[model samples]
Each structure stands twice: as C-alpha cells, then as structure tokens.
Target: MILDIYKDAFEYSAKNLVTLFVLGIFCLFSFLLIPIFLITGYNYRVINTAVHGVINGKDPLPDFDDLISMFIDGLKVVIVQIPYLLVPFVIFVIFGIISGQLTGILSNAIMIIGCLITLAAIIAACLMSQMGICHMAYNDGSFSKAFALSEIKEVIDEIGWSQCIATYLGLIIITLVISFVVTLIIAIIFAIFGVSGAALGADAGGIFGLGLVINSLVSMFIVGPYLSIFNSRSVGLLYTMQI
Candidate 1:
C-alpha cells in the first residue's frame, strides 16, 4: 500500500508537473504562509479524494483544479489545526509560570518533566492531526469532523496504532533523506557557480547569495510539493484501508 501510494503520487506529479510548479512558486513567496496553507489544504483534498477512491476499490489521484475551493478548504484546515497545535504551547506556558517560583533541583525536575510532557503532546498532536486532516477530507470537508475523537480513534484502530506510527516515522525518514539530497545538490551547484564567478572577477558573495535564493526556490517549488503529494497519498491510503 505504501509503495503504491508513492507510485501514484509520482505518476500524478509527472502528469501535472506545470500545476505543481506553479503551486511551488506560490509557496516560495510565502505570503505569510497563507499560500502554504492553501496548497496544503489542496493536498488534503487530494488525499480525501484518494481515500474515497481506495474505499470504492478504485484508486485515483485527484486533479489539481478548483483553486478557490481548495483555498477555502485550506482555510478550514487551519481552523481545525490551530487548537491542537496550541496544546504544547499551552503546556509550556503553564510550566513556565510555575518554574519561576521554584529553585535548584526542584526547578530542574519541573523543567525536565515539562519538556517531556511537551514533547509527548507534540508527537501525539502530529500523529492525530494527520488522521484528523484525513477525517476532514473523508467527511466532505466538514471541519467539525476532524475534531470527532471517536471517528479518529476508529480509523487509528483500523490502521493499528503501531503500524500507523511506523508508517509515519518511515515517511519522516524518507523526507529527511530527500531534503538532504536536494539541499546537497543545490549547495554544489551554488559552489560551482560561485567559484566560476570569482574567477571571472564577479562578486563571490553576491553569487553565493543568489545561489541561496535559487536554492530556496528550487526546494520550495519542487521538493515541497512532491513531498506533500506523496504524504497526502500515503495518509489517504492508510485511512482507506480501515473504511
């Protein structure tokens, strides 16, 4: 299922390279991360589509169309996500308030526990939120559906907790590898150009700076979208199995 998810994502990207490229460019601009969220929401919509197709025994990679709707859906996704994301921050704030009153070992112990709790909450949020996003997509873009704890639990149960964690961890590892390779290539290209520019009496610093911008554009435009598509498909596929 994982292999198929990646294969489908690659095939979809290959077929819709121009669309992905545009989205990537928008992502590079940042626009206060609004564009990033919209693109992410669109990816969620794609995952939702893929999930339904799998449930119906016909897997399909959703088309990248309907920009307005995708943007709205992405907005809804942000709405669904903010509270969950705040969990760890809230934890830290509470601990931070109490820490000032303590001293020595007691303070250190509280800090340690606080850090652990915050980390655990973050990990939980990360895993649950992915499933929550899937739920939102699966339930016809209903934002409330994402917060439906029981439904989320059912999907996890179907997917098996251990397997779900393993799948996500594996995806993280794969993502890191891809990121490293992309960054390395970008760095190498920049170094080569910087050296050539220096030999030609051009400013090495300016050339290197330009390389950084180019690297950002390439990573954002290419790697970012591809990974998003791949991950959306993987999550959607996992959700489809239990449905």
Candidate 2:
C-alpha cells in the first residue's frame, strides 16, 4: 500500500510535469505579487482532489486550471486553520503569565511543564489542522465541518490508530530522506564549483553564496509540489479506508 502511494504520486507528477512545473514556479515566487494566495489555493485544491479521490476510490492529481476558486478555497482553509496555528502561541502566553508568580524549584518545574505542554499543543495543532482541512474538503469547504470531532473520530476509527500513525510517520521519514538527499547533492555540486572557482582565481565566495540561493530555489521547485501531492494522497488514502 505504501509503495503504491508513492508510485501513484510519482506517476501523477510525471503525467503532469508541465502543470507541476507551473505550480512549482508560482510557489517559488510566493513572496511576489500576492502569489502566496495562489499557491495556497492550489494547495487547497490538491487536498480537495485528494479527498475526492478517497471518496471515489481512485487517486488522481487535481488539475491546475481554476485559479480563482482555488484561491478562495485556500483562503477558507487558512480561516479554518487559524486557531490551530495560534495554539502554540497561546500556550506560551499562558505559561508566561504564570511563570513570574513562581520561584526556585517551583519556577523550574513550571518552566519544564510549560515547555512540554507547549510542544504537545503544537503537535496537536498540526495533527488537528491536517484532519480539519481534510474534513472541510470532504464537506465541500464548510468551515464547521473541520471542527466536527465526532466525525473526525469516526474516520480515524475506521482507518485504525496504528495505520494512521504509521502513515504519518512514514511520510515524515520520506520527507526527511528527500530533504537530506537534495541538500547533500546541492552541497556537493556547490563544493565542486567552489573549488573550481577558487582555482581559477575568481570570486569563490560570491560563487558559493550565489549557489546557496540558487540551490534553495531549485530544491523548492523540485520538491514542493511533489511533497504536497504526496502528503495529500497519503491522507486521502487513509480517509478512503473508512469507506
């Protein structure tokens, strides 16, 4: 199943290379001309497509043709996720408010507990955000659906806790491996260039520094859409198990 998940993702990307590259470029330019909204909208579309695939028993990459709707859908998802995004900040703020009231061992204990609670809050927020977004997608972008805990629980129960956890952990490992390999390759390429540049008495520092920027952009271009699609597919597959 796991192998099939990645295989499907790779095939989808290969089939839509032009679409993927266009989306990847827009995402890379997110800081310019409000492209962030477009990027987010496309991401939301990816999730929406994933949910559709899950419900229909077939996973296919979403088309990148609906710019306006995708942007709106992405904006809706951002609205749905706002609270989850704030959880860690809220946790820390509460901790800060009470930290001054304690001292010595009590202060140390409070700090330790606060850190643990904050970490847990962050994790919970992330987990819930993913599920919440999926819920919204499944329910046609209804905001309330994202917070429907009972419905979420039913889906999770169907998927089984072990499978859910395993899928998530597997995605994490896959991401880490891809990131490490890309970074390593970029580093080696730059290292070779740096040596050649220095040997030729060119500005090796400038060449190396420029390589860093280019490498990051190249990595973003190559990895961003693929990871997004892979993650959406993984979650969608999990959601399908309930049916």
Candidate 3:
C-alpha cells in the first residue's frame, strides 16, 4: 500500500514536466505571496482529484489554468493550517518565558521537559494539520470542514492512528534522506569549486555569496516544488484509504 502511494505520487508528479517546471517557477517567486497560494491551491487540487479518482481523459495532475479559484482555495488551506501550528508555537513561547525566569537545576529540568512537550506538540500538530487539509479537500474545499475536529478524528479512527503516524513519519524520513543527500552533493560541488573556502579569502567573498545564491535557487526552484507535490499527492492518496 505504501509503495503504491509513493509510486502513484511519483508518476503523478512527473507526468507533466512543463507543469512541474511552472510550479517550481512559482515556488521561486513565492515571496510575492500569491505564488505560494497558487502552489497551495494546486496541492488542494491534487487532493481533490485523487479523492474523486481521475476521470477518463482528465489529467491526474491538475493544471495551473484557474489562478483566481486556486488563490482562494490556497487561502482556505493556509487558514486551516494556522491554528493547528499555533498550538505548538504557543507552547514553545510559554516554556521560553518560564525557563527565562528560573535558574539552576529546576530551570534546566523545566527547560528539558518543555522541549520534549513542545516536540510532541509539534508532531501532533503536523499529523492533525495533514488530516485537516485532506478533510478540506475531501469536502470540496470547505473551510469549515478542515476544522471539523470530530470528523477529522473520525477519519483518523477509520484509518487507524498507528497507520497514520507511520505514514507521516515515513514521509518525513524520506524527505530528510533526500534533503541530506542533496545538501551533501551541493556542499561537495561548492568545495571542489573553492566556494566553500571562499569565505577565508578577502577577495573571494563574492564567490561565497554566489554559491549561496545558487544553492538557494536550486532549493527553491527544484527540490521545493518536487517535494511539495510528492508529499501532497502521497497524502491525498493516503486519504483515499478512509473512503
């Protein structure tokens, strides 16, 4: 089942090189805000498409043809995500304040405990938000459905919590492994080109800066979009199990 999910996501993402490149370009300009929404909306569309099962003659991967509607759907996605993330954010902030006011062993203990709690909260939030996003997609982009906690819980129940957590962790592990390899290769390339050692030379500052720029562009334009699409598609397919 897991292999099928990943295989489908890979095929779906690679089905149209032009579409993927366009998404990568949008990711490159995501700082402009609208592009991010468009990307998010596209992910939503992927989920919606997967849930309904792609119709004959329809593309499994959605096109970027409907910018206005995509932008609005993206807004709903972001809105659904905020509160789930806020739980961990608030917990971290509170712990920071309390830890700052204390001293000695008690402070260290509190800090350690807080860190653990915050990490747990973060994991929980991520799991919930992933489901929430899918729930919204399942309901045809209903913003309210995203926060329908009971409904979300019911879906999780149907999927089984163990399977949900395992799937989420699998995605994270795969992403991390790919990211580590990519970063290592980039580092080696820069090292061979003397970019890594450029910072030590007075005249090589520009070279070092150029390396940074190149790395950022690669991440933003290629890795970012590919992973985003893969993850969204995988999650969307996973959601199909509950239905």
Candidate 4:
C-alpha cells in the first residue's frame, strides 16, 4: 500500500508537473518584459489558483484566471503584507543563536531544539499564507480568514508534516542537483580552453544562481502538479486515517 502510495504520488507528480509548467511558461513569457511580472503581479495569483485547483481536482483554468485577477486586485494588499513575513524570519534568526548554543552546551541539543522551533515558526508563517491564498482560491474565502490563526490545523493536517517538508526539501534538492550538474559540465568545457568558468564571463556560479531563481518557478512547473494530485489523495487518506 505504501509502495502504491509512493508510485501514485510520483506518477501523479509527473503528469501535473508538465501541464503546470507549460501553462506557467506560456503566461510568464507572455508578460515577461512588462513591469507587472516584477511584482509577480498577476502571474503569482494565476499560478497559485491553478496549482490549488489542480490539486483539488477542480478546473485549473478558473483558478488560473482567478489568480490573474487576484493579482490585480490585491496589489495594494500585497505591498502592505509582504514585509510582515520578515518578522517571523527575524524571529527565526534570533532563535537560531539559541539553537546554535546547543552545540557547546549540550552537544547541540538545545541549539537543535531552538533551530527546530525557529524552523517550525517559519514554516507556520509560510503555511498560513499558503492556506490563506489557497482557501481564497478554492472557496472565495476572505484573506483575513485565510490568514487567521484558526485555519492552520486544517492546512497541516490535510497536507501532513512529512509531505510539506518533503515537498519543499525535494524541490530544493532537485534544483540544486540540476544546477550543480549543469555548472560542472559547463566548467569542464571552459577548463579545456584553459579558462576558469567563474573568472571568465562564462560563470557557472552566476548561471547556477540565476537557475536557482528560475528553477524555483520551474519546480512549480515540474513538481507542483504532482503535489496537487498527491494532496488530493492525501485528503482521502486523511479521512481514512481518521476513521
């Protein structure tokens, strides 16, 4: 059953991944040069809606369109709210010192504990925002309700700790692996010419850096769809587990 779950998860990821990317790229490139993309203006909302829709087995188009419109509507809201995310991050940094203190004091135990708490806080913050947006996209919920402290259990319970950590971790790992392999190959090519890739304009590091940013979106493209489907199954699984 676990194997089946794993297979279903990965296969589900692959199919949806392709669709999300193609659609995302189409919309993204369509507005590439415009200033709006910088704000991630419409592009963000569209992608968010589509992603959530796909996960819930709804029509992705509505989500995509809603995302676009939401971006336009929420511009001011975004400007106001974006900076607040930093607070928890700052908390995370402060706690990180405490977490670090674990090593010398308790062989890193306290530090590890502090770090975990900080990470949990950071995750909680992001999760809250995600649920807020997803709930709005899914059900016309208000942004306030979305961000309310109450809905977090629903998000974490539905998504599961393993899946959330794995999803974020997987995307990071895959992106780094791809970026590394590509850079190494590029470096070797440059090395044959007695040129240092980083020293020359042909900097793999820059390419990797650029790719990391691009790849985050590409991850949404590549892995996000599968996540939606897997999440759908997870919802059902949650019901079963509860029973």
- Candidate 3, residues 1-243: lDDT per residue as tens digits? 777777777677767767777888988788999999999998888878876663122446787886999999888888888999999999988988899899998888888889999999998898889889888888877788888999989988998888888888888987888777886788677665675355555445565566677777777766777788888887877777788
Whole-model lDDT values for every prediction: 0.78, 0.74, 0.81, 0.48
Q: 1-243, model 2: which lDDT tens digit per residue?
A: 656666665565555666667777888687784567776677777777766774334545677676888778777777777888798989888887788788888887887889899987776676677777888888888889888978877777777767776777788888889878887888788888999999999888888898788777766776776776667666665666676
TM-score for each predicted model, relative to the true structure: 0.85, 0.85, 0.84, 0.49
- The C-alpha stretches of model 2 lying farther than 4 A from their native spots are 1-7, 10-14, 54-58, 200-202
- Ordered from best to worst TM-score, the candidate numbers read 1, 2, 3, 4
Q: What is the lDDT of residue 15 in candidate 3?
A: 74
User: Candidate 4 overall Cα lDDT vs. reference?
Assistant: 0.48
RMSD of each: 2.8, 2.8, 4.0, 8.1
Worst 10 residues of 2 by lDDT: 54-63
Q: Pull out the clashing pairs in model 4.
A: 13-226, 45-67, 46-67, 99-111, 102-108, 102-111, 103-108
Summarize candidate 4's per-residue lDDT along 115-188 as a digit string, tens digits. 67767776656545544455444444355644554564566576576665555455445546655665566555
For TM-score, candidate 1 versus 2, the one ahead is 1
Candidate that scores best on lDDT: 3
Supply candidate 4's per-residue lDDT for 157: 72
RMSD in Å for candidate 2, one decimal?
2.8
Indicate which candidate wins on TM-score: 1
Question: CA lDDT of 35 in candidate 2?
Answer: 69
Q: Lowest lDDT 10-mer window, candidate 4?
A: 234-243
Using TM-score as the measure, name the better of candidate 1 and candidate 3.
Answer: 1
* Model 2 CA lDDT for position 179: 78
The reply for model 4, stretches above 4 Å from the true place, is 1-39, 46-52, 55-84, 90-116, 193-243
